[model samples]
Structure formats: structure tokens, C-alpha cells
Target: MGQGQPRRHHQVPQFYLRGFADDSDRVKVVRFGEQPRTFVTSVKNVAVEANFYKVDWLDAVREDLAEKLIGKVEDAAVEPLRLLAQHGELTVQQRGDVATWVVLQYLRGRGKRVDSVGLQKLMLRADLALGGKQRLASRLGLDDSAEVDALWDSIVVRGELADPPTMRYSHLRTMFSSTISKVAAAYVQAHWQVVTFQRRRLFTSDQPVCLWRAPDDDPGVGLLTADAVSIPLNHTTGLVIFPQIPSGITGESAPTTQYHRWFLAHTWMSAEELLILHPDDELPDWLPAYREARLGTLGLPDIQQFIDIGEAWRTHQDRSQPAAEVSF
Candidate 1:
């Protein structure tokens, strides 16, 4: 490290994603003793490590109930309105009113303003969930809150729909994970991506490792140390950060939030999970809160599984490759 000089750019080492077609499972393996020293190959039978994009509530509801709820708004009460509006299954007035109610119900579903719990429950079932108030209020094209409140009161008494029981954050958390992972998985499914692999070999002249060529250097080559991918996970930092996504495309138009979509496709988190996300900032604003709030709750056990998987993989690859039959 020296002043008055630019930070050095270490040349990245190149490697092939080699693999042979497996007979039964059909997987390719980047192996040794092959004809060409450096070449690319596809790993068909590779057991891809499952990135845990898990969620809950998938098993909570029954079969028929689940089918009815699929693509529904998800809120216990307002789901019906969203279902009808989204599916083009409602009348013009019904659709307009229901859509408005969907927005309002979502805002209030967090229970941030639950002063009168009974009224909140009533709103959840009738005015907000069922768009009962929206129906009457929209008839006169009135957006005033007083009129909507008046309508809300009218529907609850008229319908007499029972209120739902109390639920806590656990219910919300499951819904949150399910919703986020769905968006993230969809994003990843749509991104065109590449993952390269690499390996090492002995130098022809037995020269020592050198990173870069200097301005006043000799024309003859020298040994080079490069940031080689495909090494054991332990050899380097096992991370692939999507700092910034590429903009614009040649063919089809990109999504408006393409960056957000790309982020979820590459990163561990999802679009919804990153609702208040700040990808541009050097450090994420909610990193501390997320780890403290979520990770602390997971409760880790003894004997970590991936303690040295990276290192072991690198070592295995090196061992499999016979060290330069002639090191000179």
C-alpha cells in the first residue's frame, strides 16, 4: 500500500466450468488428466446447493381453501375484492370500488392505526375487506373520508359479518417471507446470467509470480498470480455481490424496476424483502436491524456445516490435479 499511486487491479484468473455427462443423473465434473489443460466444460450432474428461499403458510390452509386463495390479495378479509378486481370477474363499478378498497385495506392491515379495535375488525370484514363502503361511496363519486366512514358503518350493520380472531407478528412474518421469496424467485427466473469456473498450471520458464507488467519492463513474460474462480470456497471470499445491474437491453424492453429485479435474482434477498431497500448506498440502512431482529431469532446450534467447505473444495481440486508433471 503506497500513496500517490492508484489501487492495483489484480488480474482475475480464468477457469472452465468443466463436467462430464453422468449416465444416470447426467452431471458434468471439472476434472483432471484431460487432453486440453485449460478448457471449458458443462457440469450436468452437479448437485446445486439449494439456497434456502423458504417461506410459511403453504400448509396452514386446506386444499380447496388454498386454491380459492391463490393469487388472492392475501389479507383475510380484503382478499375477495382483489381476486374479483384482478381477474376481471367483477362489474365496472364493483371493480373500481374494490380496487380502491384493496389499496386502503393494505395500508391499514399493518394495524398501525388501530384505535378502535372493534371498528377496525368491522372495516376488515365489510368496508375495507369487502369494499362495502367503496361501493356506496363510489356511487356519488365522493372521495371524502366522512362519507366513506358513514358508508362503512352502514355496511357492517347491514351485512352482520363476524369479526376475525386476534393474530400476532408470527402470522405476518410467514406471510412476509412467502410474499418476498415468490417475487425473488420470479426475478431470478427471468435474469440472463453466467457463472464461470477456472483452474491453475505451471509456467513455461519457471518465472516467479508477477501481477502486472510495468511500463519499463522486459518483453519476456513472468509468472502471474490471479484471482482464480472455481477454487475451493476457503481460498477466497465466497461472495458474488451484484453491486450494480446493467441497464438497457437489445431486444425486449426491461422492467421499470429492472435493477430491483436483478438484485433479487442475484442476491439472497427478494424484492419485497427489500421494500425499503437502499442498494446504491455503501451500507444498507436496515442491515443492523435485519440481522439483529431476524438472525437472532433463528437460534444457531453446535457444529456448523459449512465451516471449511470452500477450503476443502479448493484442496480437493488441487489434489486431483497432478502438480505439473514437470514444474520447469
Candidate 2:
């Protein structure tokens, strides 16, 4: 609305499974004197996710990142979204190819009537052999790439794309480069305190936080607060969203599982105003216009309608006996 005001987008929180390596006991602490090399691949992943929300690090934070890394914070701001989106799309295409191969092979292996669901599961296997792919193709009587693509899309559109068929840690590690590591280390130096179980606690933030959670955590949930946020951790990376130390809970005094810490973190984090950023430049030429046109269109349902629908659905369900029904 103002000359220098930022554009705003309503944030809709979508959950994904946490991405983290299970081993937490072996985390190496990067002390202030440790030789800092490029950890770019790791930082790139964090940056890309942040980019989707259009968040820019504060100036001081950017400088700290630069001192620790090889590139500018600006590059981190833009590149992750562009690169990761490309990676996801390409990986999906490759998976489609693999799925086709497997389907053709499966056809030849069995004389039974084809099950679409089973075929879908076969495509999901880590190593579907060339022979299997061919057998499936022969059995299904399909020689078309379009059919494969269609089948892939049918499954992917249902959120299968969230968990890609082929995810290689090495392939992703290559993206971060050493520079990103330096930035992360620098951030750790300033804000994090080492705790038991090789975890770190974050105490302050000049701006909104950049959080990553472990895979064990629920993907759909984040701890939101005025000064903190919990993000899903990237797999095979050191980046994570540390819950703040609670009022009476020190790192050593905290519960054995640290589940209570996370619980408190979630309580505080969820209370904050969610910032969802969208920049016009991030979209293709036609998309911005399309998005604008969709706003205020007739088919759109507001929050009240959603609540009404939920109420109607509940009412339709068989209720043996009801004392009271609370509405959201």
C-alpha cells in the first residue's frame, strides 16, 4: 500500500514429512575456531524453502552468512527456489520414465489382469530392473510415453510428489557447496547453544527465523511465535529448528525425550502471526494474472463456508448420542 511496503500473500500451512537423518548422537559441533569450509549444499536447501515464502535475511544476518560462506545472501534468496523446483521437476520426469519401464516389464511377468494400484506400487520400488520394466510394458500392451506420464500425474497429483521416488543425499549435498555451510556455522556461532543429545537451542531472532525440523516430527505442524518458528529439517543436513529453552527448563534439566521442549516450542510458535510472502517476480508472466483473476471469483469459498461444510459433514455422520458439538 505504501511506496516501500512489501507485497503480502496469505499463508496456507501445508505439512510435509520431516527430512532428517535418524542419527543424532554423532553431530559435530562447529566451534568458533573450527576450519569453516563450504557447506553450500545444506544452506541452499534452507534458502530455497525460505525463498518460496519470499523471506530475506536481515542485513546483519546476511553479512554474517557472507563471512562464513562464499556467496552473497542475495544469491541464497533467489537460487534455492529456482534450482530446487527444477530438481523436483526433473526428478519427477525421471521417475515417470522409470515407472514406464517397470510397468512394461510387469506386464510380461504376469498373465493376470493388471491392477493399477499394484502397478503404482511397483513403480515406487527403489530398483525396478530393466527386465521388469519391459515385462510390465509387454504385459500391459502399452508403448506410449503419454500413458506413462498420465499414470504418473494421476498418482503425483494426490501428493505423492511430496515424497519423491528417488532421493539421494549425495545429489542434494552437492548443491549446498561449502559457502552455505559457513553461513550456517556463522548463524550457529551467534544464536545457538549446544545441549545434550547433540541438539542446539535458539534464544533470539532479530527477524523471522529460518527453521528446519527432523523427519521424526510431523511435517504438517510448525511451532510459530512472534520470535520463533519450527521448520522441518532437511535430510542429511545439520540445519534444524531448535525449540526455545522453556521458562524453567534448561537443556540439562529438560525431559529425557525432549518431547516436552518441542511441545512448549509448538505452543509458543503457533501463537504468532504467520508470515507468508509472495513476490511477483517469482511467477511466470501469465501466472500472476491468472492468480489475480482467481481472487474473488464465484467458486471460491471463504472460512465461514468451510466451517459450515464441516458442520454439515458432522451432522450427516451417524451419532449414537450427542451431548454437545463445539464449532471451530
What value does the lDDT take at residue 97 in candidate 2?
31
Q: What is the lDDT of residue 267 in candidate 2?
A: 25
Query: Candidate 1: which stretches are off by over 4 Å?
Result: 1-124, 127-167, 170-177, 191-328
Candidate RMSDs in Å, in order, are: 32.1, 24.6
Worst 10 residues of 2 by lDDT: 289-298
Q: What ranges in model 2 sit over 4 Å off?
A: 1-156, 159-166, 170-176, 188-263, 266-328
Query: CA lDDT of each candidate?
Result: 0.26, 0.26
- Please write out the lDDT profile of model 1 over residues 136-224, one tens digit for every residue: 56765889989777655554434344433333223333333444344323222221122222221111000011122234535432112
Task: Please state the error at residue 169 of candidate 2 in Å.
Answer: 3.8
TM-score of 1: 0.16
